[model samples]
Each structure stands twice: as C-alpha cells, then as structure tokens.
Target: MKGKYVEAKERLRGSIAPLVTPFKRNYEIDLDKQRELIEFQITNGTHGISVTGTSGEPSSLTVDERITVMENAVKTIDGRVPFVPGTGSVNQAETLHLTKVAQEMGADAAMVIVPYYNKPNQQALYNHFKTVADSVDLPIIVYNIPGRTGVNLEVNTLARLVEDCPNIIGVKESNKDFEHVNRVLLYCGRDFLLYSGIELLCYPMLAIGGAGSISATANVEPKKVAEMHNAWESGNLEKAQNLHFELMKLNDVLFKDTNPAPVKAALGMMGKIEPVLRPPMGLPSKEVLKEIHQTLIEYGKDVQNTFDM
Candidate 1:
C-alpha cells in the first residue's frame, strides 16, 4: 500500500485525459478505437490516462463493459503513463466490484464518484467511501461532482475520510465553486492531490496548488492542454495563461450540449473516432454541430473537409 501510494503520488499529475468512450455507429464499445485514443494521448504529451470517467459514459456501460474498458486501457497504456479508471457507481456493491477489478488490473488508482441520485448525506458519503477504500489496496481518489451527483461531499467530511482512511489519497473536483477546492486543500493539507474535473477551471486550479486536471478538452487538444500544465510547472505563467484563454472557446464548445456528445462530434470531425453515442445520449442539434464545427476550425483542427457545412 505504501508503494502504491508513492507511485500514485509521483505519476498522477498533469493533464490526465478523461477519454470519451468511442462507439461504433451501431453503438457497440469500440475497443480498437479506445486503444487509438489512448495512443493519441500518449503520443501528444498527455501526462496520464483516466478511462471510463464522466466523458466515457460509464453510466451507459454494463459492469463487464466498464471492466473491459479498464483492462484495455491498462494494456494499451503499458506503463507509459498512469491509468486511473472511474470504478464508481450508484450501487456500493458494484463500485466495490469494479474498484477491486481495477486494483487487480494494475490501475494506478481508483476514482470513486460520490453516489448519485440517492443524495446520501456526508456521514453516509464518508462510510460509503471508507468501505470501498478499505476493500482495496489501490489509492482512492474521491470524485465530487455535485451537479451530476446531486450531493456535495463537504470539506469536513472529506477531511474526516482523509484522517480515517489511509488509502483515500485525493479528489477530482468537478464543482464550479472554487472555494470548495480551496477548503479541501486547506483542510486536507497542500500535498493532498486535487485534480480539476472542470475544464474552464483547470488553469486556475493548477495556479492554486492543484496537481492537474482530468480535462475533457484534452480529448481534442492534448498537446495544448498538456503544454499549459508543463508551462505552469516550469514557471511560465504568461504562456500558461495564454494557453488557458486560447482553450476557453473550445472548452465552452465541448459542454455546449451534454458533454461527450459535442466532444464526440469534434473527434469525429477530426477523423479520430465515430461520433456515435449511446441511447438516451444523442448527438448535438444541427445548430450545435455547426458551432462545434466552426469552433474546431478556429482551433486549427482539420474539420473543413469533414463536416458538410
């Protein structure tokens, strides 16, 4: 466990791409395309890979499918970078099962999201994460995205978990409230890792002692996203700030619809993957597509010949 902690502490920094799950037009999970996406991140300078995250549509996948995604990611990454898979679910049993699988599969850590829809209170959230943390030897990163989860794991609760659970190492904060990030850092100590799950907040978070980001924007502009982190780490704040502004439009466009949809469309336009989405998650409207197309073009992506404008 100490070795796992040390390894994760060292490697789980910088622009970790929360990869979107690629699907065929028939809507099957595309393992081949998944490998291609992982390779794309590795070749383009992303520091790490986070599979089956919010962008990967884990809610849409079965347990077996989610495990397969993690397996494929671990195999494809092949020690070139750290692999942290989202092994969380609304069901605690399922979360435990998936997280255990990730630990066995050589994942660097397990990202367990706050249980959604049920809106469990802080104590329940603490017990919930504590159970999972104790059940696995891997480092645990608590994922708090209250917008989607319908419950915010407060700073005090997180501080309690950190004190009680040795393996609960960090957090992926997706909330818009920057104060929550500050409070978590203040309470947990500065070395406690915080990765921004919000694209727009990535640079700002990094500026405030955040470890890195699990940015969806990295799906399109891996090099630029990674360079922003590298620039900041190397003390080039002006370059980092410029890249932050440069990425703002693309970041906004990615969330224009319901995420992954616009991001998938952008990837499709670039000929990287098919823009297929699962049921209940459809592609963006034509207007949104046009905006996405133009945004990609403005970012210097080769989308001029791809979409019918």
Candidate 2:
C-alpha cells in the first residue's frame, strides 16, 4: 500500500531484547547503568533492545522521563543495534504523541500495545494500530498480550491490519496461545516478523519459523539467550534445549514478582547495577530477596556484597 516498512523489518528477524531499566536506590534513572545495560546486551550479542516496553515499566515513568529515556538510549546506542520503543498510552492521542517522538528521535520503529482498560474490539484494534502506523513513517510492531492489555488481538483483526496497513510490520505475541501464533504465521507468511513475546517459549516459536524474541531474561543473560538461539539455528537441538532450561529457570525467577523486581534484584546481586524500583513496584521483600540470591548462587553466579537475603 506504501513504500517499504518491510525493508527495515528484515534487519530484525533476529534476536531482540526488551531491556530492564536500571534505577538508583534513590529511584532516579541511572544513565550510566542504562548505558552499561545496552552495551552489555549489544556486546553480549543481542540484536536490539525494545526500550520502554512493559518489561521496561513504562507505567512507572513520566512523559518527560519516557522521552528522556528514549533520547538517552538513542544516544548510548549511537546507531549500532536497532531500537524499538513502546509508546502505548491508555489514550490514543498520547500514544500518537509518543510514537511521533520516537520517529523524530531516530528510533528504528515503534511498538504500540493494545489499548488497556477500554478493551477495544477487533475493529478498534485494527484502527488503533493502523492509526499509529499511519501517523509515523517508521515501521510499527503491535504488541498483543491480552493478559496485560485485557483484550486479545484476534487473528482476523491482525490479518486485516497487516493487509491494510503496510507499515504494520510485525507483532510481539505474549498470549502463550500456539493456535493464535500458528494462525498468524500461516496467514502472514514469511513477510512479517512474529516474535515470541514469551521468553521460555522462544525455541518452539523459532521451530515454527517464527522470528526471534523480545525477552526480559535477556537483560541479565544476553549471551545465554543468544547462544541458545545460535545453537538452535546451527542444528544443535540438544544444546538449545539445555540452554532453554537455563532460560526457563531464570525466567521463572523474573516472573516470580510483578516483574523487574526479580530481574532488577538479580542485576544488583551480580553487582551489575543497583536494585531500586519506583512506587507500586518496590524492592523485593526479604523472602523474595532470599530466593533470588539462593537461585543466583545455585546458578553459579556471584551473590556477594551487592545482594543479601
């Protein structure tokens, strides 16, 4: 229907990450820590970082802080790996504003999630995604996680949007429904990138010709995830399976809390960054802290001074 959002999308059929935002004990955006995390991911072999994603906790950030985080990440990356920003707002107008900001700041693309609370139907979902895609020249990857959004993106609705909105390049499906993933892949063909939004299920998704993943676990073990993907791609199924177990265990830890809580704590334990969180999402409890430390130590990771149960 228009020029090619497809071209930009081709570069991203590989592994990407939904980065964990680093915060200080004082609850400020630690730019240095953010830089380290991006560099760590890129250096450890991640393809890209989906900044400000649900995993990145956009709800905890202000409008200006979100923009600041985007600008900071763009500056730190300096044109190495591609960048994706989750600019979804509860309101359509606010979402558009953030999407434009992302495009203007030179981000490669934007991921707008389904409108929460309002719980739009298929037509509204189509229009919502198409509207954002039409608003920006950059490619758009719609996020469909009904568990978080409270509204599933039906296959027909996604099909309609991909047919009508050329700029809608792909989706991050966290629904954990293989039937839905199957439908999207079958109808959308190899032209669209379908990333498994579920980290533990990445190998199965890739087995089905799906694209890569956008994982929170990658925040801590980028190399582990990359190695797992590389092994699977190289036909080393056994190695991939073993690596998958490692990721699954770690992901179990991450999801133990609301999110970012366990992961952020793990980062702190490794002495990679401080473990701090905004309100409503605070530092892990002593019980959670004990489990996190014990798990890390069990995984043979360092759990010295930075982390205590």
Candidate 3:
C-alpha cells in the first residue's frame, strides 16, 4: 500500500512550480506564451510544475481551459519535467472527472484540495479524498489550505486517508504548521511526503524533513528557489535559511491580496508576462502594485548579495 506512496513522495521532492497561466490582452489563454513559460522554468532548473492551483488562478479558469492547460502542460514539457494538476472541486463527481482527465493528460499526480464553500465535516472530507484516490490510478497530493478553502484537512482525517487511500501519498501543507506537518510525516513514516505550499515556510518545513515546495514564488524566480532546495539537499543549512528569510517579505506581498494578482504583477515587472488577472481577480491596486515592485526588488537585491558572496 505504501509502495506507490513512497514513489510519489520521491517524484515531488524538489522545487515544483505553481505555474501562472499567461493570458492574452483580451484575457484568453495563450498556449504559445504558456509554452515559453514552461521552457523558461525547465531550462532554469524547476523540477516540476502544477497547473490549476491557486497561483494559477484556478477559480478564474473555465473547465475547458483547465483541460486545455493540463493537456498543454504535458505536451509542452514533453517529459522534461514532472507534472501535477489540481483536481479539487466542491463535488466529488467533478473531482473524479478532473483526476481522470489529469491521468489521461499524463500528469504524474493530482493535487486535491479539501471541499470548499460547502465546508464538509471530517468524515465527508475523508470520503471526498478517498473517493478520488480510489477512482484515479495516479497518485494524489492532499492540498490543505484552510485560508482559501474555508475548511481544514485535520491531522486525524489525513492520517486515516493515508492509511486507507493508498494512493493519497502526501500533502501540500499550506497552513505553515510545522508541528502538524511533522506529525503527519512521523505518523505515516516514510510513506508520506510533506510539500510546503506556503512559499515563506519552505525553509522551516525543509528543516523538519519536508520534501520540497509546491511554491508560487518559484514561477517568478525558479533559479533561486531551486538553489535553496539544492542547498538543503547539500546540507548547507545557513544558506537555505538566509535565502528563505530573504524571500519571506516578497511572499507576504504576493499573498496580501488574492493570489496570482501580486505575483502576476511582479512577473510583469520582471517582464515575464502581463499583469492581467481575469476580471474577478482584477489587477492589484496601484499602491499594492507599487509595494510589490519594491518588495520583490528587495528580494532580488538579497539574491544579488548572496551571489556576490
């Protein structure tokens, strides 16, 4: 039962990109531009990329776009990097459909968030994840972000799912709870991978044996995030800590508003893509964008200092 879990954990143990969806001026999917972003992340050293996550503005995308992106991601990467697609929906039926689509699209795994809006109870949450895990042949990474989802994936529920749903391998622990994260790791022992979903908590999560990050920041600065993961692998504790702290401020800036807005703005500042987030997610406010530009450059300044060392 734990064999697949172990393999999936290893598959995710690196700087996985929570990829940003590039849109045209009129706000349509730009497949060619998205391909370029994939090439950029891969060439610069990102280990994996996950589509339809919060950073990808999941809610902003239509189901058709989600399918298209999933297909495009696998086809664009063409096996150069690992792929994980988000398969969470308020209903289990939709979740199953997406998970099956992800498997069909050749994703290595699917990141399933707890049911949002409806706020399911503990048992309901367990069933939702277990049903998906059992339905799909691909591995699953539980995405626990109470902040966005309005519910939590409690430790007990997680432990039970891992025990029962063999393919439910690990979690993108988003609450920044090292204590809870460590407990899950210890409970499942070697069977579970603890993926840091919060960019600011990457180092601390790694300190407690977290495998790596499903990081939003990695979309903008793939090289730096990869280097920090490499430093951790090499046992260079000080370097990893300094790099983590250095990026924390920028992380706050990006999340200050609804996700992907500030990050898309920063990427625009870096000239990676347009700052256009779809209507409901509209552009970050002028003042927020100004602060984002300043904070991110500060992160860049720190990166330069580290390189100059």
Top candidate (TM-score): 1
Better of 2 and 3 by TM-score: 2
Which tens-of-lDDT digit does each residue in 222-276 have in candidate 3? 8889889989999898888888876777778888787788778777777667667
Q: What lDDT tens digits, residue by residue, belong to model 1 across residues 51-143?
A: 888999999999999998999999999999888899999999999999999999989899999999999988899899999999988899999
Choose 1 or 3, whichever is better by lDDT.
Answer: 1
RMSD of 3: 4.3
- The CA lDDT at 241 in model 1 is 98
Best by lDDT: 1
Clashes of 1: 0
> lDDT of candidate 3?
0.82
Query: Candidate 3, clashing residue pairs?
Result: none
Clashes of each: 0, 0, 0
Q: Which ten residues in a row have the lowest lDDT in candidate 1?
A: 300-309
Candidate lDDT values, in order: 0.92, 0.84, 0.82
